[model samples]
Target: MTRSAGLSEAAVTSLLAGDSVALEGEHELTHRFTTELLTTHRISDTTYNHALQALGRDEVIDPVHVIAMYAAQAAMLNAFDIPAPETNLPA
Candidate 1:
């Protein structure tokens, strides 16, 4: 899906490897925001202000929406005891 959305292979690999801060293709601010948001459930005021300065309100909102939506989907899957799909990525 990320690839389909225009993420390069290296970027996808970096993201999967948890190198969000120095992603290969993603914008630094966006990836930083994503990492902080996912790990902490909130971004610090510093990060938020930096994101706001680098990306407009809409860009910041978009990632939040995507993260929330994915979290909700995961919760739903867990609630239903659905097995996660296997990935075809390399080991």
Candidate 2:
């Protein structure tokens, strides 16, 4: 997706490898947000401020919404013990 969106190969590789130090601007903020959100289920005040500074209020809200929606979906699947559908993509 990053490549398709015109991000450089190096940037995409660095991101996939979880190397936030190699990323800049919005990418760096997003990486930090996702890491903290998935691990702690909360964003630090510092991270929130940085995101606000870098992305403004509207943009900052987007990731939070996405995370919440994904978490809800995962919870529902887990609650029902839903089997994941087969995919052609490699594991």
Candidate 3:
């Protein structure tokens, strides 16, 4: 699905491998914010402020929505015992 959304195969592989630095463009701040949020389940004031300043209020909301939507989808899949699609990438 992400591939169909226009991300390259390599980008998808990197993301699945947790190598966010390999993702396209200068998204270091975004990666940091995501990492912190996922691991801690809460954003620090400093990180939030930095994101607000660099990404603005509207841009900051996007990651939260993406995370929430994906999490919900994963939960539904797990609840229904639905298997994820097979990938051509290496094991």
- In candidate 3, position 23 carries an lDDT of 65
Model 1 stretches astray by more than 4 angstroms: 4-6, 21-26
How many pairs collide in each candidate, listed in order?
0, 0, 0
Runs in model 2 deviating more than 4 A are 4-6, 10-22, 88-91
lDDT of 1 by residue, 20-41 (tens): 5435423666777787888899
Q: How would you encode candidate 2's per-residue C-alpha lDDT over 6-80 as one tens digit per residue?
A: 667678767667575667777777878888998898899999999998889999898889889988998999999
lDDT by candidate, in order shown: 0.80, 0.82, 0.81
lDDT of 3 by residue, 48-84 (tens): 9999998899889988999878878988999999999
Poorest stretch of ten by lDDT in candidate 1: 20-29
Candidate 1 residue 84 C-alpha distance from true site, Å: 1.2
Better of 1 and 2 by TM-score: 1
Model 3 TM-score, all chains together: 0.69
TM-score to native of every candidate shown: 0.75, 0.72, 0.69
